[model samples]
Target: MLRPAASSSSGRRRRSARSRHAPPQRSAVVPSGAPRPPQRLPAAADADGADARPAALSVRPPGPCSPRWAGSGRGYANEPRRARPSQRLPPQGGRGPRGWQRACARACARAPCLGQHQPFAACRGRKRKKERERVFSLPAGGRARWLVLPGSEMAGLTAMEKKLAEYKCNTNEAIQLKLVRFPEDLEDDNTTFNPEYSHQVFGDDEVAFGYKGLKILLYYIAGNLSTLFRIEYTSKVNEKFDCVEADDVESKIREIIPPGFCTNTDDFVSLLEKEVNFKPFGMLLHTYSVHNEEAGEDITYQIYKADMTCPGFREYHERLQTFLMWFIETASFIDVDDERWNYFLVFEKYNKDGATLFATVGYMTVYNYYVYPDKTRPRVSQMLILPPFQGEGHGAQLLETVHRYYMSSPTVLDITAEDPSENYIKLRDFVLVKLCQDMLCFSPGNLMQGFSQEMVMEAQQKLKINKQHTRRVYEILRLRATDMGDAEQSRSYRLDVKRRLIGPYKKKQRELAKMRRCLRPEELTNQLNQIDLNMQHEQLEESFQQLVSDYRRVLERLAQA
Candidate 1:
């Protein structure tokens, strides 16, 4: 009853079951020490018995370049947190849950500073000491307290201990929120192209409406300065840039930005809407456009092989993965820190009036597994072409490009996709068929000879295709080789595929017989008889028909190719 998933939440877990290999890179980062302390949110309740309004979603300032205030107890500007208890009361009316949480968070931000004295210089140089101070800090409004708390005093408890205390105290009542602007308010055709905005606002599968951009930059704080982490931009445009100066950065970003952003509006929220460009920094991946006569237009696209070692890979992936939640059913983000996982990004290039623009087409993440003594196998984990780009052969191009990338690696054993969706299967079928057609071993004469070790060997050796996938290719190719006009040949091909489909049902029957240990032969026979054999046969036929239909489609594409 389990259909092949278009995307899998546990792609790595499935790969782990099949291959045992230490990832070339660490799957996760373990902090150097026992662990940092956890922050606590102060509790607050609206004095008025009315519902609280949801506050604006908060934006998590980039960690490295986070805005910091430098002043002791109350010296810093404290608009939200400086409110006295009397002022904290909901202005004679009820507030929303979001407002309530914000109030509690603001209160928590000022709690540590109440009548406390500490010198910031004492904890300035110590990494662990600074961490302790930051850990207890409220993610919001608490920036003011960073200047007052003694880092040493903050290192009193481990993260787990603090978490336990927070759990027992029920911290859910004071949720920390981030600033986010919903795009719903924008005119239907008004476009925003900032990758960071997309990250903060959209779910993975939720495509950005009227939004398109290829360049995603990530930045972090280093030595109290905002340092560029990496810049992932499409090279298809062939534009020049410099980000060293703040003004230069802004100017370069604005040049590529589409118009009608409402940037000049006086509304603070509209101002908060970042011009859809500035992104965290990362390496620039180039994209190429392929001319396809069949599609009737030239398709400009590129596949960037993203590496884990690349700066800002993690941040870029964090923003990029928002697409998974919105597009891929059961889609899960891959562990980018894992050296074994490889990310391939596809982008479409277009000219927007005067400027060259790029929009994300789709992407795939693959995990490379050690096959044994020397060879490696790359398994496609999750694949998604955004809904706008689907059915345009972009998926096939992405998959083939990945296959070609790994084909040159002598250590690669074979290429496989993990729990492929039906659409993915069809795409794979077409790509593999097109690839193998030129190989003499897959000629019609050899294919009609039936499945053989030669087909599997040739596929694995030449194309880095796995044996299981090779067998499937052989079946489809054989069907192509068989003429339906010959009844015997068609019947054999049907049975060959049906036997594979009926395997699980046959196994279930055997398992059922083994479970009838307490039943008499007559009773067991009755139980077996009650099982709907005709229905099972019908299911098999249906599956067979559907599969044949899919195979025919692949063959038709192959014929065209």
Candidate 2:
């Protein structure tokens, strides 16, 4: 039978000394019935002159797995209705989306041995000792789409809307026509002509081909920060949508038009019919709000709250907001009221640098269909800005195009957007409120509360003032020095140390690991409450007072040391 090794005389003395002097190892898991290690937590102020009992740890493990639809006790549910997530729009990646992170961490904290609530999924397949890191993105399917439409589709949608309204109102055998949207390359003429003079060159050659086409976009952001943008546009009238650049240029550009821009967009639709010698139809506009990392390793489109990703990820989201603000400025500088053809279709590709996925949006103005002439115009409508990530106007080229094309052009009646989803109704019945006053400074949605709890209520009006759903793009860029170049070019200032980094910082890794086991913010609060309760009970126990006093004295001595 095995037995403890016989200890030499000096060894036994050393063991006894170590046991008497060393601090006890505190752990989440321990042998049952072992006297809970003497509670060593610092004493609270109210316990002065009281005997201390064993200090119990204020932290505890997290609970069980949460349900996909509801188990997340995160504050997303607590946000005000307008801030709440929409069924059509999933929770895209963001920074201020509080409850999501908190719930994920707290929930995972309850797991028996789930690692820290930090970027748990980063570098998943990477070797710990290896120097190579990973770059993550959402899985392909999880990547949402953001569509960009051209002019032909917008004109077509206007025509279709007018025709559909007439058909819906009366019963008549009417010849119904469709919209025309086209691929950009087909219209390119193979020659990358100058953006300004190209119009002069193609003036007589189907100048308004894609004018009536619309852009449909969808974006998916998987748990592992990968991005996919899927886009489809109207190509042939009453036919299929081809998102590619084809050879059948003129005919293809006449399909896939979207709804409409102005109330009287119909009034202008007929003008194009006779002038352009082509019938116009309605179009579609769709956009997805999903985000994935660009440079991080381990492209997981996961929802594991415990998993941590890059810290710079949050900063990236911030850049999106900045880019949106800049877009608003650029558009406002050119397309405001009376100048009615400047309907904006902002495609924000703030997640990945360059995308292989498709995006859905802008069927009304991707190509040249119909143009309302007003030189000094109404500004941009910056339709959708708040995002899974901050908004990005793709890059400076988009702005430069606006200046060279729209701003410099005459007879541009910058039109206002007409949306029916007018549907920005956030969840109405919100019980959670995890916002700050400062947050309202940017996203005014936070200022509203006391919404009707009924779930059936859809937005009744379209003219509602959007909670300044805009990010200060120009200001942020100025602060970050991005005004000098495109985001990629501007952000090229990576730390020299990044390349010099031999491996993952050991201290950072250890801290991340420890945070996995650290108690949550709410739990810490609960522990303080428990300690208060225990102290109250100890006041009645005379002997406990003495123990507390002794520890307080010991703590004082340690502090002095």
lDDT of each: 0.50, 0.24
List the candidate 2 regions with Cα displacement exceeding 4 Å: 1-356, 361-376, 391-400, 412-561
Q: Candidate 1 — worst ten consecutive residues by lDDT sum?
A: 238-247
Winning model by lDDT: 1
Residues 48-140, candidate 2: write the lDDT tens digits: 111111111122222221111111112221110111112212112212222122222222211211121221211122233222211111111
Best by TM-score: 1
- TM-scores, all models, native as reference: 0.51, 0.15
Candidate 1 accuracy as TM-score: 0.51
Over 4 Å off in model 1, which ranges? Answer: 1-297, 352-357, 512-519
